[model samples]
Target: MAFPFTPSRPLWLLGCGNMAGAMLSRWLESGLDPAAVTIVDPMRTDAPEGVRLCAVPPADEPAPAALLIGIKPQIFIETAGTIDALTGPETVVISIMAGIDGATLGDRFARAGGIVRLMPNLPAALGQGASILHICRDGANAHDVADALARPLGLALWVDREALIDAGTAVSGSGPAFVYRFIDAIAKGAEKLGFAPDQAAALALATVGGAAALAAASDVSPATLADRVASPGGTTRAGLNILDADQSIDSLVARTLQAASDRAVELAEMARN
Candidate 1:
């Protein structure tokens, strides 16, 4: 319930790939001290100035205040050995690794003072991202510490029931891919109807982007917006009718989310066991 965090403490990031790199870019852009970060990735040779980056641990760097694990979920077992210096009672572990629950992560990094599982999407590269955080009710963690980790990146919220986080992941974490697929389908439809492939692709992409922006800014639901676009039994409504017929589109998306959520649940089981 109570949140506590010291703003002055340093934050270190491990595994700076696309997602984690995006988060660090946001932090640096937001004017957080780049000096506070140390990135250890065997592949990345350079980071922005004022930040220390290396392929392996430096011989004598002091322990970090917060250690964020951004490695792929499947490879967390490799982190099992980097315990003594990286995780301890003073260090808070912020895990961005998907599928691994807080309990399992805590077990992997037992020296951590507190463990929090944060699920974030790729849009974190910009300031627009959806992040879902899960912290156990009986935990020793502090909410403000989680905020300190979350607030800098983007739109952050907590899920009361951890089980729902997989739903959140299915919708937000993996939603971009789904949207892209939709866009491609639309473009392909246009091409089949005789439009040039390049123009069709561009039009579909712009249309989807603009529509999402409009929906986000509008007070009405998407269904209401669709009604506003469709004149009395007009073209948009014709498409809508087709999609509504047999509720096929809705059912397909429902199955899509179910499959993704089930995969997350299965991954949690694998990690726990």
Candidate 2:
């Protein structure tokens, strides 16, 4: 579907690496006008048809309506000065870099209209990603612009407090990797049960995919669905018993998320320093 909201000025992408490239590709596929987009990435070789690609910002162009920052957090401070000229009081800044807080972005791009921190996973390349947004200021236009840009990428959610963003980073931003690990473990378990390597991998992947699809389509909670599947005294219940015993699975997952969230806080502190 086409993005319904239009920005007052053109949009500029500060970097076009993997994450930014995914977002750009999805935006173009969703009917965004390529002519309205500009990319500034020294390493990028090209851009979508009708889109302009430049190693540096154009000297004469006016500040863009929205500037999406997709550079690495480690180099953001070093690179912030270089892009300062592109931000103005009317320009909105959106960042997808992990750990950099909205306050820091606001300080770096002080003249921009607003700042938004977005955490998106790698799945965005397939347009099935989950994104969490945290706006630094209160403005309908800024929020609308962000929503417009995020909707095509997949599930888009907004948090009231910026601190919650770290929690989101742990859950949604780092979630795909955890899911992938789970899938790999399942495949290994199947192989251990005598299934051929290739067959085990396929079965594990299909089982996860089908279960996720079913959960998405169903009205009941996943726990309810799980209960429904584990018929009284059945094999499914036998496996679930092990997983639920002493809440082992739950504790493991909680610890994993905590570690990720803690790291996000550390990164934010690093950015501040």
Candidate 3:
């Protein structure tokens, strides 16, 4: 399929770290023209062929139509002056940095046409991700442009309140790591149950992948699916009994999400300060 949106001007990626690189790769694979992109990163040596790479924003070119800020949050202060120079009244600023709030972005890029904060997971590298967006302000078609950019990477979910982005950061942004931990735990359990380590790892990975796919395809709730799988007095039921006893799993996961969300809030506070 052709790229969903084409800007009148080129899109500039401010930092090309792993997450930004993954996003750029997906966008290129989805038919975005490499010529229409520019990356400003001194350390990025692997920019896709045909895209412009510069240590600093080009001096002669007009301000970019869109700017994706993928730099480390701690370095934002050092980079803000340079980035601000490249931002014009019609440039849409999309930021993936955690902890930085819309207000701070607006303050830093006062001339930007619009501001958006996005949180995307590692799965975005494969075009299957949950991207949570908060459109802080819409100027010069920012909302539509941001949506178009997000859809190619995964499910583009928007929240009415920017605060919800922090919650989403805790859930989808940090969720993959939690899932990985659970998969490893399953593999360890399998190894303890007499399976070879490689076999246990493969089984755990496939089991989780298949179950998640099934859950997505099914119309019924996952809890209902679990019930359907666990025939009365069966092995699955016995396992479910242990997991459900005292609601231990539910409580544990709740605490985990809460901790992540709290950290996101802290990061935001630090950025503002």
lDDT scores for all predictions? 0.77, 0.87, 0.89
- How would you encode candidate 3's per-residue C-alpha lDDT over 141-182 as one tens digit per residue? 888878878888988998989988999988999999999999
Model 3 TM-score?
A: 0.96
lDDT by residue for model 2 over 1-273, one digit each (tens)?
755324446789999998899998989888888878989988999788888899988788778878899988987888887776788777778888889987777777756777888888778877889999989964436788888889889999998899989999999999999999999999999999999999999999999999999999999999999999999899999999999999999999999999999999999999998
TM-score of every model versus the real structure: 0.90, 0.94, 0.96
Worst 10 residues of 1 by lDDT: 1-10
lDDT accuracy of residue 230 in candidate 2: 99
lDDT of 2 at 192: 98
Ranking of all candidate structures by their TM-score, best first: 3, 2, 1
Q: lDDT, candidate 1, residue 165? A: 78
Stretches > 4 Å off in candidate 2: 1-8
Error of 1 at 148 (Å): 3.1
Total clashes in model 1, counting residue pairs 3 or more apart in sequence or in different chains:
1
As for candidate 1, its clashing pairs are 3-144
How do the residues 89-201 of candidate 1 rate in per-residue lDDT, one tens digit apiece? 76677777767776677667756677777788887768778888887422335455666657766789887777767887898888878989999999999999899999999
RMSD of candidates 1 onward, in order: 3.1, 1.9, 1.4
Native-referenced Cα lDDT, model 1? 0.77
